[model samples]
Target chain A: MAGITIESITKSFAGVTAVDNVSLTIEDGEFMVLLGPSGCGKTTLLRLIAGFDLPDSGRIAIGDRDVTDSPPGRRDIAMVFQSYALFPHLRVSDNIAFGLRMHHVGKDEVTSRVREAAELMGIEALLNRYPTQLSGGQRQRVAVARALVMRPSVILMDEPLSNLDALLRLQMRAELKHLLQDIKTTTVYVTHDQVEALSMGDRTAVMRDGAVLQCASPMEVYDRPGDIFVATFIGNPPMNIVRAVARDSVVKVEGVEVALPEASNLPAGTEVSIGIRAENIEVHTEALDGALPATVAVIEPLGSHLLLTLAVGAESIKASVRTDFAVKRGDPLWLELRQGSVRLLGSANQSGPSD
Target chain B: MSAAIRRPRRRATPQRQLAYAAAGLITAFMLFPLYLIAVAALQPRTAVFDYPRALYPSPFSIESMAFFLNATGILPALGRSLVIGVMTVVLALALGCPAGYAVARYRFAGRDLVQLLIVSVRAFPILILAIPLAVTFINWNLYDSVLSVALVHTVMALPLTILLAASVFLRVPSELEEAAMSMGTSRFGAVWRIVLPLSRQGLGAAALFAFVLSWNEVFAAAVLTVRNPTLPAQIVGALGQSPLPFRFAGGLALTLPALVFIFFMRPYLFSAFGQARS
Candidate 1:
């Protein structure tokens, strides 16, 4: 319902910068996910946007109104905290109506709005129960219902699905997608799970070390990472990187030749690192043209597929192959790296991993 | 892993046996004097002076009780004590609960110093407080009144109540208050609607403590008031001239109200003390 703009925001606690000069624009009615590893400042950024935290220096505007110093109550935004934060003393109906009551809405309007939100969350039967009596998922629904009852223009969620089991997380993911689509409120969700980000976000912003590395559609972030940090943090079974140096049409990895993409415009003899996703590497019976010969260091069966940890010279890389493959530790294998998927990183900027 | 299913076989060791024995001895030691007072209170006046105090009084009579209940000035003393206790509880709760909330919620400068002051207030002997209060009361023409006694008792009870209640309120999740604020409630409204309801058990316990402190206090009561003395001050005032039955009966009368209140509020006491410690 409303767009949020954050400009040059930074937050520090006891001289330790938790969120650096981060700026982002969230479109109206968009479902955005801030995806990062733990302690990457995604949650901090969300809290700043929701007005739970004050930025050391920044301007925050919601729907063209500068809300930098406004208290959370005046921001017209709702947040579902990680702990669900349901008022244990209040019944589910009262919890949903709390925002309304604070604004002095009449009893009849409170009840009607509470009922509408409860029905929207399919928690109509649970209105009379206290938070302690509800299951984790039920309490979470109540938290969501409480946030939604106010019809806030923006709803911020901090790892709302982290406490659920795998199956429940999947179910909630689909439910949340449908729910947000129907309400169309500008929602900003934060999570450490790549799967959740990819599945839920209209656009996913990958962050690390107090900065947003990249913000794009999930597929774009995966396929065209802005930097080395986004390249490694956005995909499952993480992308594998091996140090290499380019020289006259060939890239050398530990004195062995590796192919380069023709479209890659890096200068010749540039010291770089080559990145490849596990799924992009194909296994073959024998060494073929442009394929690297490697030995299987380990094989992990994942019911549907086998994860082969392959030893390419001194470095190891993982490849997802069919579980039916007759592969074992110490077995010789041929790995074909998908040419288009190879990401080359310049060596001069080598530092620590972003996340 | 199946071995985990087996129940542990605990043998009685000398150390464990000694610990149980010590606990039983301590409990009996604490209750024995109260039991003796109860026996003396129920006996006839003649039975009280008979040497070798009665472990149990036979044909218990309420005559001493009726005597105290009907005595010209005794009823007024009892009324004064009740008034003082109620006033002390109310005043202490009003001032201390909010002070406690401030100490627990804010991190302003000198907060630790304030906390240290409250802790030290509990340790200062009440006798020291009585000396200064006596001079202040006499100078102000406030001597021998329930108001003077209630003010002194509040001084005695305020620190303890605030410390305990503040700890109780601190256990309440700040996240809940934040949630309320984000839901459009101001800071004051959040505390009023959410924090206060959750902390009622603690506040009640603090009130009960304030009442008991005022109800049983004697030194300050004696120092501050005479003709309008509280029950404890009256008991102490009549000590030399009083008979055994009268002494025991007065003690029983003074303690019974609080004992009954405690019994009625027993369920909340555990949660209150637990919250304080946690």
Candidate 2:
């Protein structure tokens, strides 16, 4: 129902900083995901927004109210925990109605709203069952319904689908995305799974060490990572990072000239790290113009594509080629890093990745 | 993998046979005394003194039982013990659950030391505790009353009850409480609606323990109450130098209530059905 604005938030526990000075804005109806590895402060930031933990120094505003100092009950925000923390003693109907009752809604209204939520989650048959009687996926739906039935100003999810099996996680990812979009409530989702972030988030905030590395659309984060960490962390087999140097309008990579769109922006003689996505590298069986010669070190045939580990001089890189590309280990090949697909990551020599 | 499917393959192995034997021996060791008491309590007055006692009562007579039941003070004292037991359960749960919850959920300074002290209250000998309490009760004008005996029993049962309650509370995940709070309930509401209901079985066990302790405590009841002693304290006077039938009858009377208490409390002491419940 309302967007949340967080400003300069910094939280620490027992002298260790969990959420450093960070600022973010979640627009109304925006599905913002905070994505990062463990100990990266994504969960901590979500807790701060949920009013479970107060930041040491910051302002958190839900809609127009400053809830930085308020308790979780007064914040009017709902959360779905990773463990699907449903009240085990309560049947599904009561669990869904719990928040409504807490807010002191009418009994009739609570029943109708719980019923509506159960239908929305396709769990109407499970309304009379205890949480222990439900499967993992069923419990997940109940937890989500429990949150959505409240219809609070904002909703927060902390790795909500992590406990489900892989296939179920995939199925729930789409279901949750559609559910959140249909509700049109501002949401903040936290997870370490890059696939979840890329698939579900309207805007993904890549974070590390208690700071946001990049906040962009999923495709933007994938194609144009803001820094070396974002580039390497967001990919599956991970993006290839090759040390390069900028001279004029050209960047030299492993003693070979590689053109980059932003090569002119870098200072001369500055060492830069070029990030290339595995699927971005063009592989050719025969030597062609402006291509670097390489030997295939490893080949992983993944049905639809061939994941080739190419050895270029002393450096190795991964390339996802078409399944028809016939190549074996130790086979000579040529690779072309296109200007559009090649990302100029942080300066590799002195300063940490230019943020 | 169903346990029923996996269980059949491992049955009657050497280790399982040895385990069953050991368990049977222990069960007999515990039940043999009760069996002897039952056999003697049923014997007629003349048959009680036979040199070779009957392992099981033959032509069982209810003479000892009738005489024991007809004893004037027995019923009143039994009623008094029931009151004390019930009172002890209620009082212990009310006073101990919060302290147990605090110990389980909070991280205050000296938390470990406080738990140790709470548990160490039992290390003081019961006789040592009973004498001082008797003096205190007299000074407070609470001596020779069911309330006085129940209060003494509460003190004796507190440490274990608190310990049991804490372990029970610890098992109910704090995540459930946080989830409730996030849904708009305050901390107090969450504990009342979620934590208490989820931990009822554990709390029930704690209550049962306090009840059994109060029911069986003879020393404190003897030292504190004269006119209103509990069942155990009332019968101890007739135990020594009493007729054989009377001794066996008193033993059965003393043990029967505890057996009934355990019978009612069995479900709470173990898991409810197959899964856990409040």
Candidate 3:
């Protein structure tokens, strides 16, 4: 029910920093996702926020309270672990009632809340069954139901859908978003899945090497990546980084020069790279105006379209074309970059174009 | 390739039959000594000495058992052994469960060293330590007491108990406890509500081991006590002087309790030994 303010919360193990000097402010009821690949410290950050692990330095606050020193129980928080981690010995009903019992809620209220939570999860029939008796999906629901019953100020989930199958994960992902939205509890979800982060989070904080590289709205992150890493990491088949050189008001991309009038003040002879998304390029069978000639290298078929890996000069770029468009490997085609799709991924010393 | 994915067996296969026969042979080999002891204990005193000793308890009589039970210091020693075994089980569990949990759950300084030391405690023979322990017990006025023998037995059984309990605790993932703690339960509360229940059967197996260890231990019991010797010590002390039937009867008396204990504890023992169905 409260916003979480994480202020330079740093934690390390054995001389390795798991959560670096990271600062973030999540507004009340916001679904903030800590997205990253394996070993990128997303789970470590979530653990710190949950009060399971203390930071070596810096502070964390939920609402107005500085809960940096508190244990998980004292922080008014609930967590759904990646493994579901349901009590194997207890029935679904008892597992849901466990937190209420720990917090010393009344008997009647515990019973009512357990029933309500079970019903909400569509698992009222599973109340009598132990966790071992339940399938992976059922166990996931029970784990979620267990946390939701607590109704803590903040709900922390560490890849809660990672254990389920693909279809179930997708279904649960959508259902969980709606469920959390209705509850309006400030939630911090940790995940490595880019699609999940893009689809679910109010704001996605993409992290790498224990530090957040970018934190922005999913669309903002998708359309305008802050750095080369985000540009490549966020997209499927990823954004193609082709070699380019800035020349006054124009950038020369391989043999083809494209007009980038926004860089009119750019000094000549400065080398740069342009990141173009796979879907951002339009493919033409015949030679067309404002299109660069390319040879198709690889074709992978999707249900509705084919992802074409095209060799444009020395660089390979991906372009998704409709299945009916009719293209083959080794065939020569022309590609036109969509407006605003080409992004300048600049070097450390130069201010090429990207802010 | 898929001739029959899972066909119902009409009868035991040849290989399975051979395996069953081998298993039955091993079982008989293991249980024959106990059967012999039982038969000797049940036979009349004169019949116990008969050559090609009775395979069955024919001309059945409790004469030797009666004599063994009535022997001076035997019943008291049996009682003392039972008490000490019970005490060892309790102490090993009380101390070992937490120690095991700590070893399994925590990453403190010298944790690996602690585990090494625990495992090494069983490397040397307890026989060498018994006299020194007896001396220390005498100085502390704990000598010749049931508690002294039980303490020694606890030391003897503890490493096994701790190692077994730690493995048991490891099976109940630490995340379940962390999840409980994250949901308002304190660490201790989480352990009680989550960990203890999950590991209860494994701990039961550990208790059975500790009790059997205490029940059979003779050297420390003999060294630590004179008047209040355990059943094993008493039987060993009397066996040399007592007649053959009395020895057989004493053997039965000592082995019977542990066998009955293992019988009751078979479920936990089976699970701990990994015969448990998922």
Candidate 4:
């Protein structure tokens, strides 16, 4: 296994930049997930690391060797594509053994390794089947087995679970977590799904518009996002931001005063945005101290919890509450914002709430 | 509820019956000329000249076929045509497959221009090319040779072969080749092991098309060769001089190989044509 170090990589296609100047270090045996929305350059960065594409302006090092100029075949990395691009003409065993054969491994060793990979992936019974004969989940397993059989130092996966159905994606997500842990390969996985990133990655890198927003552990990314984009992009239902003007110790939002963190020293009337996660807001049936009165606009039942869309002044905010709360649309309620849960953004680039 | 559970038996509507009748008429119309040729080839020479031209063989005889086979230089011409057809298919595929793969897989300057050139080559009459080519060959000392005729046939077959083979290669997913390369195979090795095998059926269809094009062509064959005439050239040269049964026998012989080739390529022809349009 080897760590990959990328330095200030930038790539452009026909005058439009797809990957900007970005640098990252994927440690040895680390399961790093590059998480972002579509067109965020996560997949392009993975392809760059895999040597399928070259960065126009920077360097890439796998282990201690600089492989920025090397071809994909000499990079000693295997990739599981989003399409599970198995050779249609080859059976499962042959597909698994193809890399070993290309490396000129002995015939007996290739067969044994293929069988071992197949067994490792629980696809031993499917060794003789062609790709067309396998189900979607089975084909996914075969693709993973094909990558694993090569035993490359790094394994790159580009949305490998996106093609599976929701249930199968959940099951395979857990299985892949365990599998990668057992194998202990330096794996770089790219996905737009935050749930998968948080559940599987030892470290998650959030990206936007061809730039890395934050690279940290999943919990830190969720709790202490580095920027407004990372704050809104990481959570379910996303974080809600209300534009406010900061005073010494409190911020004014639609004539209501909310306490700011103690270290906040912004000038009075400075433009700022206050972010609060949906789950962090407490709903009260009766009016309470320091609670803002709001009207419930919509109620969504989610079996275990209820999502309430509240019209607070002119802005609508979502709050997750216990399902037992018998709140209907147009019901008057008071919402309490939890202390230390609010993330204040004073940067000019921070904007209003995102849907 | 019980009636809903049981499926209704379908009866052919008048529109469907009319469609069937129309299709049957078209099939019969297409097969009639083949039947007439077979009948004339099987009949005696005297019977072929009878009133209304025997739609059915009155007296079956192999005398006309025997005469055609025994004619001086006729068998050698037939052998020459077979060799030319086989060589044309081989050469066209060998040259056209790579060109087709490049056109299909790569983006380069003048790629569209190259395809336009290939397509436009078919716009001009082959006789125009063959006449100039005949002069060039005579100057190069290649006149009246089977190789000259085969080379001309390859020129006639190459454009369509490249187009068809390009479509064939386009049907193989490029990601499979990328996967192969990522798994330690070089670009060429990936194409050889993955793309080639996946595209075997389509290439076979392209080869069959080249064979049929070479087999049925006559203008270039006649213009390119004189002493070493191909079968079509020999038959055309014998037209109006040979007896009716002998001409019909030659026609039937020329059509036979194409039919057999199509028969062998029946399964792949469907998908080949389907992908070509795409």
Candidate 5:
């Protein structure tokens, strides 16, 4: 278990930067996930930390050792690849023992470690079978077992659960979280799925266009995004940002005047945006004070809950409502933004207001 | 269930029947020469040359095979051919596997040029290269030796062996090698332990091709070597004066060993070729 620090790391291919000037510190034994859309450099960042790729310019250190230029084998890291890359010719036992054999571990130690890792992965019955004989889920288990048997200080996984079916993916996700927690190994997991990062990461780094937008606890990223990109990318339905003007302690959203908190500071007629999440939008049938009149455009019943998509003036927003609320489409509705729910975002060049 | 089976029969239009018949006829046409050779090899000496070439041998016996096997210096030539074939395969594999790997894995300065050269070598005839090498062999005092024949055969086999093995190596996802490296195996160790084992069937197919190519090559052996001639060269040389029975029996003997090898490798061959397609 070791902490890994990446400072100003950049990687480029044919003049196109794959990972550009990224910096992050993963504390000892933290499950840090790099989450982004596909081709957003999350995997590249993981590979850079694993020493599978060398940064064009920067330094990476694991524990106290500088590993920027070291080969992956010398970096003391193990990786479970996305494809599960098990050796087809070797049985599960040999696959698990591959690293041990390469490091010249004695026969008895290799056997014990292989058996132990296989048992940990719940694949002891499959020790003698080849990878081709295993199903997708079993192959994933074997891949994880192979990586675990190495006992590396840091374990890096690149979308390891992407190949499994949906139900299997969820089961394996829980299994991976439980296993990592028990072992307390420092792990860096990369995936394009925000849900995976939100559910599994001790801290999640949201990335876009080869740079990290925010790295924080899932709640911090959800409740307090640093920029419009994070505000838009981190949430499931995402935060809604509408054009508005903030001036003289008052914000006008479209044609409606919204009262700002006393002591709120803003210049007169300042152009800004107001951001709100779906859960913060309160729906009412009759027009009331501090509420905007709207029409419910669509209602989606999600078994235990309902999502009412409403159109107010020319702007549309979604509100999470209860399932038995008896709301239908094409109904007149008035929704009010909860107290302090509206977050004012400054102009494009200016940073968004901190939560 | 009976109607379901009969539906396909009712749907078999005239065009479909003609297509099926054509395929069957073509297959039969391709197999006829092999059938004729086997029949001739089994006939008695007098029956081998009988008019209208017997579709089935009358009084079929192993007499011709016995004669061919017991001929003066024939068995020695066959042994020499086997040795040369095996040696050629070993050399091609040793030289080609790493070169193929380098081509597949690395991005050296002249990588594209090197790959192009290997591919272009196939377009030219091997006989064109063999003739010059034969002269050089005589000058170097390697003429009429197994080494000379095997060396020339290696050149003939290297390009295809390298290309095929390189394609095979490419099919083995590089992620496996990378995963091995991540597990603390050096690059070479990863390839040696992982990639090589995974590509065994491909290597076997490459080796089989090299062996068959060297085993059946007559031009290089005929031109470069004399006393230690391969079986093909011996049979060709014997044909100049030997009777019909000798030619048929010798040709049959030469073809049988390669057939045995192909049969043994039939499953792997089909799989390797299928991988090549995919």
Candidate 6:
């Protein structure tokens, strides 16, 4: 119901900056996922928006009202904690109704709302049981139900599915996506899982070292990551970057030349790196034109596909090929880079291309 | 064929037998005094003072209990002890719960120093505080009052109660309270609704401990009051002069409440001792 605007937010703890000068805007009814590894300040940014931790210098606005100095209770927002954080002593119905009761809603309304939320979560049978009696997935539902009953403008979730086992996490993840889409509430979700971010988020904000590296649609982030870190962090087995020198439309990698996109406009003799996703390289058994010859170092079977680690000169790159393809370690294999799959970066240390 | 292939039941090994013997000896050593108290309380007045001591209850009579209840002022003293014990527990918990919650949840300037001060109070003997407290009570016209004795007992029990309650509060995750706050309840309401309920067993344990401390304290009650004596004060006052039957009956009276209390508090006590299944 409300969009959140964070302007120049900076927070520090014990003189170490946890969230640097960062700004982001979450549009109304958008599912914005803050994704990164641990210690990347994603959680800190969520906490700041939730009014749990005040930023050192910044302004936070929900809708049109500035909530930068308000307490969490005054923010008209609800949060589903990573731990589920259900009251152990309260039954599931009472847990879901807690927010309404706190706001002094009428008795009949509280009961009806509790019932409605329970039904929404498909947990009507669990209404009388305490949190300790519920499994991890059930507890997660109760947590979401509790947040939903609040009917807040925004819901903040911090890795709510992380505690569930693999199958349960997957099921809950799909269910959560459907629930959020049905509610259409402005939600901020934090997670370290790339697949979760890609599948669930309307837009994913990738963060690193207390700064936002890229904030874009999931595919855009996956296909055109803003930097070396974002490129490496967003994909499984990660994007492979090889040191190269660019001259005209061609880049030479360890004496092997690979063609760039037709729009290549970099200056001649420019030092660059070429990033290729594991799925973007084709493996050929025989030497082919415009292909780089390499020796397979390792092959990891992953059910439907095989991940081949190849030694190209001094660098190692991975390629995902069909499982039926005959491949083995120490075999001579030629790899051809697919067009439009390569991203050119100027320097390994630089965040993005100079252009 | 399956039965023939089945494993035999193992017998207790030598080490296990020796462990059982050692445990039995220690149990008997601990129970011997309690047995002697029971025997002495049940014996006739004449048999109580016999040289070898009456090892068994013979010619059992309630005469000692009857005489102690009627001849001495023990009945009123028993009532006074119960009142003081209840008052001490109420006061300790009323003051200790919030202090404990504050210490457990908040980080403030001098928090460590405050904790240290509370813990340091336990290093000194209660007698050291009782004499000074008695002098202060006399000056303030609180002398010879049950309230004065209860106040002293509260001091004796408060430090341990605070430390124990703090640990209990620590076990209830702070995230639950934060989640409640985000759901629109204020911090105080969150604590009242969530934290207190989770810590109920711990607080019960603390209250029971305070009650026991007040019920069994003799020195402070003896020093602080003359007219409204607690059971322990009365027992200590008549210790040497009273006959063996009266003394034994007094000891039983002083101990019976604590034993009954522990029996009733077994469930909460298990959780207080960190034995609850999460």
Candidate of highest lDDT: 3
Shift of residue B142 alpha carbon in model 6, Å: 1.5
Task: Give per-residue CA lDDT, model 1, range A78-178, as digits (tens).
Answer: 99988999988888898999999998899999999999999999999999988877898899899999999999999999999999888988999899889
Per-model C-alpha lDDT, please?
Answer: 0.85, 0.87, 0.89, 0.87, 0.85, 0.88
- Per-residue lDDT of candidate 2, residues A1-355 (tens digit): 7888999999999899999899998898999999999999999999999888889998999999999999998888889999999998899999999989988999999999999999999999999999978999999999999999998888899999999999999999999999989999999999999999999999999998899989999999999988878887887878888888887767887678887775377778888888899998999889987787899999998888989999998778999999988778899998998657888877885333233
For each candidate, report its DockQ versus the true two-chain complex. Answer: 0.46, 0.50, 0.50, 0.47, 0.47, 0.43
* Model 1 bad stretches (over 4 Å): A247-250, A254-265, A352-355, B1-25, B138-141, B275-278
Give the DockQ of candidate 4. Answer: 0.47
- Model 4 scores a TM of 0.94
lDDT of 3 at A176: 98
State the number of backbone clashes in model 1.
Answer: 0
DockQ of 2: 0.50
Tens-place lDDT per residue, model 6, B84-154, is 99999999998898899899988899999999999888788878888888899999999999899888888
> What lDDT tens digits, residue by residue, belong to model 4 across residues A175-280?
9999999999999999999999999999999988788989999998987778778888888877777777788888877777888656578888888878888998
Considering the two chains of model 1, state its CAPRI-style docking category: acceptable
Q: What is the TM-score of chain A alone in each candidate?
A: 0.94, 0.97, 0.95, 0.96, 0.94, 0.96
Chain B TM-score of candidate 4 stands at 0.89
Candidate 3 wrongly placed segments (more than 4 Å): A264-266, A348-355, B1-18
Worst 10 residues of 2 chain A by lDDT: A346-355
State chain A's TM-score for model 3.
Answer: 0.95
Interface RMSD of 3: 6.0
